[model samples]
Target: MQITFWGAARTVTGSCFLLEHEGHKFLVDCGMFQGNKALKQRNYSDFPFNPAEIDFVLLTHAHIDHSGLLPKLCKHGFKGNIWATEGTVDLCSVMLPDSAHIQESEVEQKNRRLLRAGQPTIEPIYTMEDAAKTLTLFKGIKYHQLVKPAENIEVVFYDAGHILGSSVIQIKYTEAGHEQIVVFSGDLGRYEHYILHDPDNIEKADYLVMESTYGIRFHEEEKSKEDLAKIINDTFKRGGNVIIPAFAVDRCQDIIMHLNSLVEAGLMKQGSIYVDSPLSVKATDIFCDHPEYFDEDTKALAEKYGTCPLKTKNIIFSETTEDSIALNKVKSGAIIISASGMADAGRIKHHLRHNLWRPESTVLFVGYQAEGTLGRRLVNGEKIVRIHGEEIDVKAQIVALDGYSAHGDQTEMLKWLSNIKEKPQNIFLVHGEESAMGQFAEIISQKTGIATLIPEMGESYKLNDLAHFVEKQKLAIDESGDMMELYLDINQQISQMMRAKEWQKLFDIKEFLHKIS
Candidate 1:
């Protein structure tokens, strides 16, 4: 068996992995590229392998970064079944079509400009019809249930506690008469996540493919309700609206629950709170329908409230374009929550265009912002930004509450790893920035004494000869004369040392390099 790191190798988005065994090819995730223009442009690039050749796909969740490319995969002639949890299937039912709409809308807007400039027109990556067809291939599996999507491979799902029906997948396969177990940690969630259950603990695995999205950070312990209330109150006092860009699936519902609690506690004044994303409205309904997936606290909260956990007193769901446009009339005392958490697209951009330049308003971020995203630029304190091709000065207050993050932080991820009684033979970290992946590799190596590999994009590993594969990789890089590769490798080593605070070792390495030069 062989594995390839097609995406999310040294970045936080575009999570695709290819597994080939005994002439059969399968995919773990067919995610879309997001964040910076370089990464986003990758979405339009041809697949490294022919999508038509893929036998099946093991979908872990419905997040766009994990499952967004199913339509494109289907459009490219993949006729295989896509296996996922029931909740994931339901979420994708709405999300995929919505994603297609966004793509179409964006392409249409870009085409107008190109038409005027006499440039070639572009097409959307996939259409709504493609998304609809992709849904026909979905085969829903219940949590903890085992199934085989291909010969000699058995798969099981564990609740990942990330979103409504997110999962950690385990694949049991046979290679050369040897049985092996490989576990994929599909965006593990926090232990005390408000809506979902804690991530399930796996007892054993031979190989582990884990995510390291927050590998170098920890979630803030401070309760975000107080901070949110203060931001709202302060903004309202100045007669401005609080515009929030949130993820439609998990973060949006989480924010709604928090706002409901604040209102119930009388900590927030009663005012119009608009959920402006149609995708979010549908996602919230799906979330409410699956009460079985909720944590104990969330279930109890639902019981106490006598309604959905997300339904607050002053909440308004705006489903139509006109209704969304009407929100612009409310200049102050309104809390507008929109989708596309990174604020790169969707109605949130329109909302930002109206309020981001207002000194009295505030733009609150309740999720992780990938590098080069609009949210990252705002959070990083860029004074001027462009929205809808118009440059706007950023006068509004920008705030990020890390406590609302859905991904488990470094400490929580380590705790999750400790659950495996026996360490895996190899641990590969993906879905993180280069620096975070480097820092995490060191921490995992020290804690478990297991070999950890951070595979670069297009890198491959043979499952049967893991040690030899790693040694070959080390030799290849060590023997290479490419200055840029050497420089990056040295920088990663220095970063790891700095993170460990080993000043002596860092100084010694720098001095040794200087002497050798």
Candidate 2:
């Protein structure tokens, strides 16, 4: 048995992992690379392994970073079933097509500039047809139900409490006449979250693959209803709009619930609230359909309101491009929530472009801003920024309330790990930056006295050979002169050249290498 870290190693996005047992190969996430251009460019690269060779994909959730690349996988010849929770399946039904639309739209916009310059146009990573086809292959499984995706493999999903229907996947399989169990913590959520249930507990596993997104940080104390009211009331008094960049799925709904409470309590005056992303509007409706997934507090709020917790008298669902554009005309007393929580893509950018230069306007960020993302730039206090080719000054009030983050904090993550009665033989950390991974690895070692490994991108590990495992070595390369080693070296160099945009030098190197060969 072997496992490969294909993505989400030393980074926060693109969460794919490959597991092989008994001649069967399957994936854990198959997510897309997000944030910086170098990472996003990976979306256009070929799969490290042939997608058609993959037996199945065990999806953890419907978050774009976790499931955005499914259509791309399908477009690249993957034709296997994708097993996920029923809620995840339903969310993907809307989210995948929305992601495809964004891809197409971004490519189209880029092509227009290329056309004017007489340059070659580029295609989207995947089209809506590919997304539609990918959806047809979904096989919904209920939480906690054990199912077999391949021979000698049994899989079960536990509530991760991150986003709606997110899961911690457990896999039990036998290899070389011995049984082994692997548990993957797929973005564990905070305890006592507003809408979702707490993360489920597990007691045993031979090996564990965990996420450390917040390993070195702790979230701020939860704000009271009054705090939200204060921000809104203050912004309104300044004759400015509160533009919030929230995720379309859960965060948007959570913010709406808070706003509804504030209004009902008379803490803030009733005002117009525009949901600018069409995807967010659709996701809000989906959130309404899954009342069973809500916690007692959220359910009670819904009952008290006698309607969906996300709905209010003053709320407006902006479903059309014109309607979204019209929102930029509003000067004050409007709470505008848009998708792409990071504010890197979607209508959020348009709203920011128009409002960011106004001193009275407020831009509230309610999610994690990845390194090198536009959201991070604004959050980090960049004085000036360019949006849609227009340079804009950063004059608006920027605030980040990380209490609204879906991912749990460092203490919460440690508590989740400490719950397992028997510590695993090895804990492999992924889905985090280098600094966080290093810090968390040390903390886990000191607290649990268990060994931990921080795998790098494209790193592989042989699970059956415990004693021979060498951390940070390329997989299956036993000698310095091996063909596989040379191939990996060449691939690494080519990737570096591509990232550096050294097209001519890259071609010359390739030609020289071919001649030498």
Candidate 3:
């Protein structure tokens, strides 16, 4: 048996991992890599392994960074089932296709330049058709149902509380004659979020793979709500447009909830608030579909108030392009929440271009901004920014509310790990940047005294004892198992370079590994 880190090892985007036991393979999460141009370029390249060879894909949530590459896998020929909660499936139905649309349009635009340069035009990574095809392979299941995705490999889903349908997967497998439990903490959510339920309890595991997106920082949840209200009140009083680039999934909904509370409490007027993104419109519907995933506070609010906060009067779900275009009509004191939270692309760019130059306008950030993204530049106080190929001076009030982040902070990450009964022989720190992962690695070693390895992309750790148990257990390999083949192909493609270069490919391989494993 072996565990390979393909993606999200030392950086925050493109998550994939592979587990091989007894010649059978299983994938953990297949997320898309995001941020800087170089990282985004990787999304256009082929998978190191054959997508068709993967047996099964275990999904964690619906965030594009976690599950955006599914359409590409399907386009490349993966035919196995994708297991996820019902909410996750529904979210993907909208997200994956949207991602495909973005890719297709991007490729088309890029190909024109390539063709002019006398280079052969390349194909989009995947098409909307491929995304449509992938949707049929999704198998929706309830949380905590112990089922074997493959023979002798029991899989269970626990609430991660990161977003609607988010989960932490508990995997119990036998290799050789030994039993091992491997837990993948998909993206740990803050204990108390505005919309979703609290993160589920940590189950015991022999091996635990956890996320450390905010491992180096501390966030105050209460202060964030207060700050948000203050920002809105200040902006409304001054007659400025408050523009927020929020992720349509959790952050967008959460912000709306906060705004709704402010309006009801009379701290802020019920000013015109528009959620201007098609993805957000669909996402809100999905949020309404699953009341089971809501926290007690959210449930009580829903019961007491007919519609959830942000979905009612004064808060408009701007679904159509025309609706979004109509926002320009309201020039004063209007609040617009758009998508692509990092401000890399999407409707947020248009909003920024229109409002960032206004001294009274405010661009309130309430999510994590990966390095090299427009959001990070804004946070760092870049005075001028380019939007859709035009440079615009940034004169608006820029405020970042770190407390509103969905990912657990450094203390929370450690607290979650402390819940585990015993640390396994190996602990892998992933889904974070180098700084965050390094800090997390050091703290885990000091606190738990466990050997933690952050593998570079495509790096393989041979489990001599674990492999023996895998053979002893003789788990069944279904026709769906393409994961092993993919891993082997990736290894073969990068091994020479990986060894000769001494970890140059480590991060890239880890990002790639994040997809299938």
My TM-score estimates for the predictions, one after another, are 0.89, 0.90, 0.88
lDDT order of candidates, top first: 1, 2, 3
The sequence of per-residue lDDT tens digits that candidate 1 reaches over residues 253-325 is 9888888888888889777788999999999999998998999999998899798878756689999999999
Give the alpha carbon lDDT tens digit for every residue of 85-137 in model 2. Answer: 98899999999998999999988876675566555667788999999999999
In model 3, what is the error at residue 21, expressed in angstroms? 1.4
**Which is the winner by lDDT between candidate 2 and candidate 3?**
2
Give the TM-score comparing model 3 with the true structure, all chains together: 0.88
lDDT of 3 by residue, 22-123 (tens): 767767778888987657666766676678788889999999888988888888889999999999999999999999999889778766655565555667
Q: For every model in order, what is the number of clashing pairs? A: 0, 0, 40
Native-referenced Cα lDDT, model 2: 0.87
